[model samples]
Target: MVVSSVEKPIAKQPHASRLYRELAPAYEAVWPILARKRIRAAIGNLELDAGHRLLEVGVGTGMSLDSYPQSIDITGVDLSTEMLAQAQRLVEEERWSNVRLLPMNAEELLFDDSSFDVVTSFHVISVVSDPRRMMREVVRVCKPGGKILIVNHFRSNNSWIARMVDSAGAVTRRLGWRTDLNLHEITADFPLRVERCYKTSPTSLFTILTATKLDA
Candidate 1:
């Protein structure tokens, strides 16, 4: 899974860049309200230690900064510089000296193998064109036995409910989300063992799964 600096650009279209930039401002205002309960529940489930080296993909506005223990070393990456600027502002104001934010795509992470003890992404899978590639990159940088935490929403499994999700997905897709993603299918492709899996909400709109990288 070693990648080089000469790797091809991860974002294939200019529209994707423009799309995120456009949503960055709206996201800051709306995401906290829409996702607060789910985020709090998910963060409560994370099992992190003081010395963990954590990498958070798509750290928009740094909403989850307070979830990490003060003693842990945290590195956050996002595709939007505008969003990262907000995250930086929050991190600086909170006096989180050990945390750093960088602008990077989840599909092509610029890090050495096994560099992190915990890798996480919150509500980002549906927006990425290649979520499988992003998961692979997350696993690539995570050490053997390290943790990978995901909190996201996908189409419900219940046929009746799934139909409703599909309908809503149609509208949301135009705003950069594939709401019909089969998360179970995506998780199967990764080299990780499930440590915990649970639903955060009854409607199946939100889920939290924590897993560990298998030894090579």
Candidate 2:
């Protein structure tokens, strides 16, 4: 997946919400160029139809809103109020009546089990405080046979590159994400069955991972 260039690490663990809050204003300007193509590739083939309920975790600024079919209902949650506010503005300005934005923690989703037909997170898992908890919550809220999609940068398999990225984790954390998160560890023991995995970005740094939730 798409790894960011290494920069100096910040000394302290910055508050997650605060980091996004500070980045919210500049997010749209910066991320669209870097993330749009990969995100579109990830959600483009979802089997959405009218009445389908979709939940997006860590839906920063709602950049992916336009990619979904208008017939589907969408609920998006993020930890940053500033990001949600921007998302709200985009939803209103674009007149996407089917979308709703809320400030929420991905690790502690408020919805009941099987509440949604689809669950997705774009460029989010690597940034969350607890990726395992976030994935579990995503799985919990999705219906059996539902699709769960994730688009993010995973650590490189190249030993040298992986080592460099892992060594730079302290610096990358300051920018709001880790560079060395292992994809296998993230999906370990999860109930979902892998359906597809492919590189989505031109540089092959970002990947699209799709899975189907199995019956209980």
Candidate 3:
């Protein structure tokens, strides 16, 4: 998308970057328990083969890095360099030769079109300045017939539950993420098909969605 220098200020998430940068270590400590199992399960469901190219958007602290099969090539990118540093240390300590981590914005990925066989993003869509832009980038970089997997909390179809969450949108927005992002709206124009939508557990707020890009 080539975000301009002038627009960069608005594009860069001051509050979100600061919060995640300072708390990168703490995020490593706390987020895994809540997400590891689900992320692993969803990636597992993809049944990725050896040599498949995979890109993970917003790969904070490399939380889901270990879950991906070592046989596949993995590229993980995030806007927070501090978080990337944390993820880098893990990549080094684990000696994951198949994994590469970089600092990049989710909404403006630098790769060429159809660059990867699979794409993933977890708990990150709502944090970007433009969720739909991020999604568009995801679709652009994925190869035809490739796969896309996203795990996030979107506004519920259930009016009562959605209303309760929407009421908190102002607060969450200030805190760095929005609570009222609609999944359908964000995904409607993409050339992807939703194959499955599920939760780690019945009560979990996050939805793990799997989709496939239509063949060229």
Candidate 4:
């Protein structure tokens, strides 16, 4: 069973899947190359070992799936069934015995508390209707002291750059992504010990955040 059950919150936003379904082919073509280096570096920072349980939220097309250590167990979830279908095909082609792909909502993760040793999401925070809620759920499912990785484009701290980017917000929003998401705004309230939050390069548009969920 490549696809698993997901809850109804996703149904409230049917367009989410529609937009991605149409974009699936292009998404698989483009995102992997653009995100590979930063994602690989971020995963390297996780220091994963055999037997670790990892949950990747918004596992779109499984672009970053092969970068993870095969020894560890991986469960990848995505709201877009079209994307998940591509991911399932990849899992099969590679014969990844340790990976499971499921159709799931990021904001409504159906998992037990502390179910995974690590949780990671890429370029997905802003795509959701409520990024903070998605984050709360991200931290919720991760084991205490477990690592959490988020790699996404957030409003730049540079004033001029932020305003310049804001000009494109209208266009991006119409296409289903908001350009004005702020990193600190979404993550500040969580019980996470932020280890590092930095841009991959001086010119990189995305930020890489590495944090550990605080113990209850």
Off by over 4 Å in 4: 1-10
Q: What lDDT does each candidate get?
A: 0.82, 0.84, 0.86, 0.87
Per residue, candidate 1 scores C-alpha lDDT tens digits across 1-216 of 224552344555434455877777887888898876776777677787888899999888898888778989999988877788889999989999999887788888889989999998988887888888888888999999999988887667788888978878767888787878887767886788998878865655787888999987
Q: What would the per-residue lDDT of candidate 3 be over residues 144-208, giving only the tens digit for each residue? A: 99999999998888898889888888887876888888889788978989999888887677889
Q: Which residue pairs of candidate 4 clash?
A: none
lDDT of 4 by residue, 1-216 (tens): 123355444555445667998999998788777888888888888889899999999898988888999999999998888899999999999999999987788887888889999999998889888889999989999999899999999999899999988998898887788888988888887889999998878998889999999977
Q: Candidate 2 residues 155-176, lDDT tens each?
A: 9888876787788888988888
lDDT of 4: 0.87
Model 1, which residues run further than 4 Å from truth? 1-16
Give the local distance difference test score of model 3. Answer: 0.86
Winner on TM-score between 3 and 4 is: 4
Clash total of candidate 3: 0
Model 3 residue pairs with clashes: none
- Which prediction has more favorable TM-score, 1 or 2? 1
Query: Model 2 shows how many backbone clashes?
Result: 5
Worst 10 residues of 4 by lDDT: 1-10
